[model samples]
Target: MINPFAPIGRGVLGVLAEIGRFTAFAARAAASCFAPPVFAGQLLRQCMAIGYYSLPVIGLTAVFIGAALALNIYVGGARFNAESFVPNIVVLGITRELGPVLAGLMLAGRVSAGIAAEIGTMRVTEQLDAMTTLSTDPFKFLIAPRVMAATITLPLLVVVADIIGVMGGYLVAVNSLDFNGATYLRNTFDFLENQDVILGLVKAAVFGFIIAAMGAYQGYNSSGGALGVGRATTNAVVGSIVLILALNYLITAFFVE
Candidate 1:
């Protein structure tokens, strides 16, 4: 007789095992981050790769989202004859939620996949093994710097995104929506509190850490050959995006409640 419960039990065990492995990997990576000989150069390079190179895509995404958000809010507000509130709402939405979340998601797609592919390729090519043979710790040299860079740089990226997004909204409101430029800017600036921006930045940092860690974890553990590397890359992006969205809600709830 086939035991139906056996399949369910095995599936649960597999999930638990994966969680355990990921936790262990994260712990080791965190430890390596602090106990390092401090690879400053590698860290800087990663900062450039993860933060600087990502600005164009992030900016473009923010502008379009902000513009669309403004348009939507204006249309919705018009139904209630509250269209004047568009600027206030737009700024609030961007700083409190959309800015960090969108930036994080974009980076997850770009940075996570790149990290996973690079590290996965090294793993399959035995370059990581070669590093070990040369007395270089892979976690410290490769993983730690990337993780640190992401954590540090993402907030800055979010700040830029926030600025660009607000400007996008302003342009649309003033030019297309028949909004007074001065009033729009004033309402945007006046309505936002410091805590809103701070919370967004905090979320960015956490998202950044998750992005780098997931990429490194998936790549470091991948086997097989080219196929395995591709799988790791996909997993890295998917995992980072899922974690980012889940954490965003939790963080928002914490701040709101």
Candidate 2:
């Protein structure tokens, strides 16, 4: 009774099972996002919790990153008497790449973990089910608002991070490294194009959506108990980070021309 088709059947079933689950969840979340008794208060709270609360961490990270980037660029560009390009490169790199990527990764670690743990706990305690029994659309009331808030707020955070990061670089260039402030700002503005800034903002928006969606998806689907919740939290952070990197490349490619 050794069946050669058994392995193939099992593999096929596994793929189908995952696809079905993913599709069902996506459909439900999407439907709830639009067909909602809009939870404005919940959404605002989430925006503040996920967005405003993250500013300190993002700002600190951006400052250090910008300073280091300036130093590196200065050193590298100095090698060939290309020191004049330092401000331009630093600004472009921080605004167009580092700002969005770092902000996204930071949020992924902070916000995603919180969302996953909170939602996973609600699920484990059967609170989500209780809401369901009460004729409440759990997806609309919880997941959609959080996701929408994150998608809207994360870009604003990145924008702020970009400004702070550039200022950090400017400080290094002006005070620590002894350069003219006026000259540095002039070079930064002159070298930076509108497209560069736009590209970064676009990247930020995509990263925001990815972070929220991944967190919501993993948390909403988590099962088991404490262990499952922990796993989902871990997955949310890891998944969001990976997706941020992958999407960055794709977006870069699109704008490369």
Candidate 3:
């Protein structure tokens, strides 16, 4: 007799096995991050690549998101004669949620895929093996630097995103919404607290770690050739986004209470 639940059980087992492997890889990567023989130059280069280079996209996205958020908040709040809450809500939304989440998602698509492709190509081409032969630990030289860079830079990016996001809301409110510039700024500042910003930055750090870790994990384990690299890249992006969203909710819940 054919069991209907067989396929479902196998799928569940497969997912659990994947989770276990990823958790093991993440542990090794975290340990390598703290181990000695730090590569300063590689770390700096990665910081530039992952953080500085990502600014334009993050800024552009944040600004537009903030503007749109303000518009929506205004429209929604107007029904309750609470349109004046737009500045407060916009600032709160940008600092506490949108800035970090949007930045993380953007980096998952951009930085995570780039890391996966680069490392996966190295893996398939035997470049990573050559490093092993040369007595240089690839984890220390490659993974650690990229991981450290992403972890350090993402919070900074979120800070910039928050600032730009607020400015975007301010511009829209003052110009299009007929709000007084001073009043909007005042409300935005008055309602926003340091704890909110801190929690968001903390989320950015975790998201950054997830982005780099997932990319490195997929690329490091990739096999075959071009097809493998392509698969790794896709997995890196998808895995990062899923982890970021899941962790975002968890972290928010932790901090909210």
Greater lDDT among 1 and 2 belongs to 1
Report the error of model 3 at residue 207, Å.
0.2
Q: Which regions in candidate 2 have their CA more than 4 angstroms from the true location?
A: 1-28
TM-score winner between candidates 2 and 3: 3
Per-residue lDDT over 1-53 for candidate 1, one digit per residue giving the tens place of the 0 to 100 score: 99989999999999889878988998888889999499999999999999999
Question: Which clashing pairs does model 1 show?
Answer: none
Clashes of 3: 0
Q: Estimate each model's TM-score.
A: 0.97, 0.90, 0.99
- lDDT of candidate 3 vs native? 0.95
Residue 196 displacement in candidate 2 (angstroms): 1.5
TM-score of 1: 0.97
| lDDT (CA) per prediction | 0.94, 0.87, 0.95
lDDT by residue for model 2 (115-228), tens: 888988999889999999999888888888887887788789988888899899999999878889999999988998988888988998778777777787888889999999
For this target, which candidate reaches the highest lDDT against the unseen true structure? 3
Candidate 3 on 154-253: residue-level lDDT in tens? 9999999999999999889989999999999999989999999999999999999999999999999999999999999999999999999999999999
Q: How close is candidate 3 to the true structure, as a TM-score?
A: 0.99
